[model samples]
Target chain A: MKAAVIGIGLIGGSMALALKEKGLIEKAIGVDNNVTHTTKALELGLVDDINSLEQAVQESDLVILAVPVHAISGLLPRVLDLVDRQVVMDVGSTKAAMLEVIASHPKRSRFVASHPMWGTEYSGPEAAVKDAFAGRATVICNREESDKDAVTLVEDLYTTLGMHLVYMDAAAHDVHVAYVSHISHITSFALANTVLEKEREEDAIFELASAGFASTVRLAKSNPETWASIFMENRENVLDVLNEHISQLRKFKACLEKENIEYLAELMANANKIKRILK
Target chain B: MKAAVIGIGLIGGSMALALKEKGLIEKAIGVDNNVTHTTKALELGLVDDINSLEQAVQESDLVILAVPVHAISGLLPRVLDLVDRQVVMDVGSTKAAMLEVIASHPKRSRFVASHPMWGTEYSGPEAAVKDAFAGRATVICNREESDKDAVTLVEDLYTTLGMHLVYMDAAAHDVHVAYVSHISHITSFALANTVLEKEREEDAIFELASAGFASTVRLAKSNPETWASIFMENRENVLDVLNEHISQLRKFKACLEKENIEYLAELMANANKIKRILK
Candidate 1:
């Protein structure tokens, strides 16, 4: 099968590489507004060729949207308009608002919504890496809304990439990811800023930062354009999670103020239960 | 050389392993309040033998107080009472309070306050690994206060472990680590708590959590007994940095609430400066 990947940055570029590496695609086409990204995707062998969105969608058996969440909502309906037999899939971070926008499209069944639960804090074609999706979970949202053949084709492609698939409603997927993924970026950005603000001695930070600080703030290096769009697209859920996170930080601050070691320890012990899920 | 590791937990156990692996010590003696930790330290080959704190200190040419900061402050005086020609060093997270408590002791010259800027969230001897300190910074705090020979011995030892040595004052070490290390743990614990409190679907979290979430929340699983003591011991510096972190988070929340995407993007872009230091 021939595949076209739109917005060929990290996710799209990596997806293009995965499809080609796994022999799931005879040819992978790249489509990006950034000419440099399109050219780099080709140069890096992430895609077979660069093409206009319309041209790529017209020629490929599969068209994947790997754009920002904001762009996905706008482009999903237009892509659905352009497809008849070609299976369309999106790998955006949030699903609810985009799914809602495309819900009434006549060709909605031809489109599948998915989020490959894999990414690094880096982006762009240069950041694309081979074997990026294996051993990761891929969420298929509102799978029932898609045509059976479309869902099956996408699921099979992800499985070929060695990804485990989970199914969830669009709304539920957004809420869960807001807690697990979106807020992580926010706090990490804040953490970087906190150090930048308070520890003006940049030399000390470089001299003193442990592996823990590096991993903890790693997400702060994520693409701002992409994450800002994500935060805006899933505004309510992001806001809700951000409030809870801030409240949690305040609890730690309050406990420290009162020297209430017991309460603080209890909080951390509760958090430590995450080991069961994470490990 | 003979070495005694007082705590026989993560830091100490790992230290013992590094000493053995690098041929820095012929024998490592373990001393922990917990009997199980001592047995496990030996069973895991983290130490050659287990002994009482005084016995370990007296027998070894070098003594490492690798306990929590609270324990280190108390044990340092007693360990000093037992030492004359032997060198003593500590690997605790904080230094100001501990250093102040022993500032007037004659053996203060024999004690070197060093904090290896390396650790994992897990604890105890079983969590120890060989060659744990390579490529990490080992900060020797208040170096001028340590005896010249003792300082040279540690500087050479860490250098042999493939570590880069940095020297800073105790007060500055405490303040800087609050921004770089302690605050990372606080935010990670808070991030985990936020998810556990709001996202009730444990299965969804297990399925949807990406590598980013795993790294961001990694420190949340740190040993509570160890962390609570560190927080209390460095209470002032921690509170100072935590307030700054909250202020930064509030900035993100405000921009998000107002839908001022520009400011939020700028905040993240500024945070991206961490790459210069961390990389």
Candidate 2:
């Protein structure tokens, strides 16, 4: 099957590379508004060819929306209008808004909403890497709403990429991602801003940043355009989690202010419980 | 040189392994209040022998205090009292408090204030690994206060372990770590708490937690005793940076609440500057 990937940046480029590497598609067609990205995607061999959106959609059996969430919200409806029998899927971070926008569309059953739970802090076509989605989870949101053929193809795509599948509704997917993904970016971004704002000694930070600091703040380097769109699209859930995060931070502040060493230990011990889940 | 590593946990056990592997020490003597640790350290071949603190100090040419920050603050003075010709040092997280307690000790010149900027989330003797400190920075605070020969010996020790040395005053080191290290732990612990408190679905978190979430929250699994002592000892500096971090996060919350997409993008762009320092 031929697959057309829109907005050929990190996710799109990697998806194209994976599908091609696994021989899941006969040809990978690229579509990106950024001429630079399209050129880089071609140079990097992430896509077999570049084509116009209309042409790519018309020629391919599969259409993958791999744009930022904001762009997906605006682009999905138009893509659906252009779709006939081709199965459509999106690899966007936020699912609720994307699914909500096309809830009433005539071709709603043609689209599968998915979030493959893998990414690097880096972006753009240059950041595309082979085997990027292996051994990770891919959330298939509102799978029952989509046509069986559409959902099956998307599942096969992720499975071929070596990902395990989890099914949930779009709203639930949004809320879960707010906790697991969106809040992480906010904390990392805020952490970088905090150090950049108050530390002032860039050389010291460069020399002294241990693996701990590097790991915690690495996501701060994520594409601003991509993350801003994600946070905004999932505004309510993101805000709710952000507020909880701030309050959680406040508890540490209070413990420090009161010199409540026991309470502080308790808080950290509670956090240690995450070991059971993560490790 | 013969070396005695007190505590015999993560930092101490790792130090023993590196010094032995590099042949920096002719023999490594382990001293720990916990017998299980001493037994484990010996079994892991991290040390040649286990001895009482007094016996170890008397026999070894160098002593390393690698206990919790609170323990180090009290233990440093006593360890200094035992020093005759031996050079003493610490690998604790906080510096100012540890240095202050022994500011007027008779053997003050014999003690080197040092922090090896490396660690993993796990702890104890089993956590020890060879060649752990390579390619990391080891801070030597208030080098001038240490005797010339003592400083040289400590510096050579870290160098043999494949670590580059950075020098700063104890106060500056404490403040810098508050920004780079301490606050990262706080954020991680708090983030873990936030998710645990709000997200009742542990399965969702376990399934959906991606590399981003894992990197940001991995430090949450750090030892509670180790971190609580570090935070309490460096309370003021930690509080200052924690306040700054909270304010930075508030900017993101504000942007989301106000639907200020441009400002949100601007904030993330600023955070992306960390890429320059970290990468």
Which candidate number has the best TM-score?
Answer: 2
Per-residue alpha-carbon lDDT of model 1 for A100-215, expressed as tens digits? 89878999999999999999999899999988999999999988899999999999999999999999998888899999899999999999999998787889999889999999
Candidate 2, residue A260: how far the Cα is off, in Å? 0.4
For candidate 1, lDDT tens digit of each residue in B1-279? Answer: 999989988889989988988899999999998989988888888899999888888899999999988988889999998998999999999999999999999789999999989899989889898879899898999898989999999999899999999999989989999988999999999999999998788999999899999999999999998999999999999999999899999999899899999998999999999889887
Query: Taking the tens digit of each residue's C-alpha lDDT, what string does model 2 give over B61-180?
Result: 999999999999889888888889999999999999888888898989999999999999999999998889999999999999999999999999899888999999999999999999
Scored by lDDT, the top model is 2
- Runs in model 2 with CA error above 4 Å? none
Clash list (residue pairs), candidate 1: none
Q: In model 1, which regions exceed 4 Å deviation?
A: none
Clashing pairs in 2: none
Span of ten consecutive residues with least summed lDDT in model 2 chain B: B17-26
Model 1 DockQ, alpha carbons vs. true complex: 0.90
Task: Tell me how each candidate scores on DockQ against the true complex.
Answer: 0.90, 0.92
Q: RMSD to the native, candidate 2?
A: 1.0
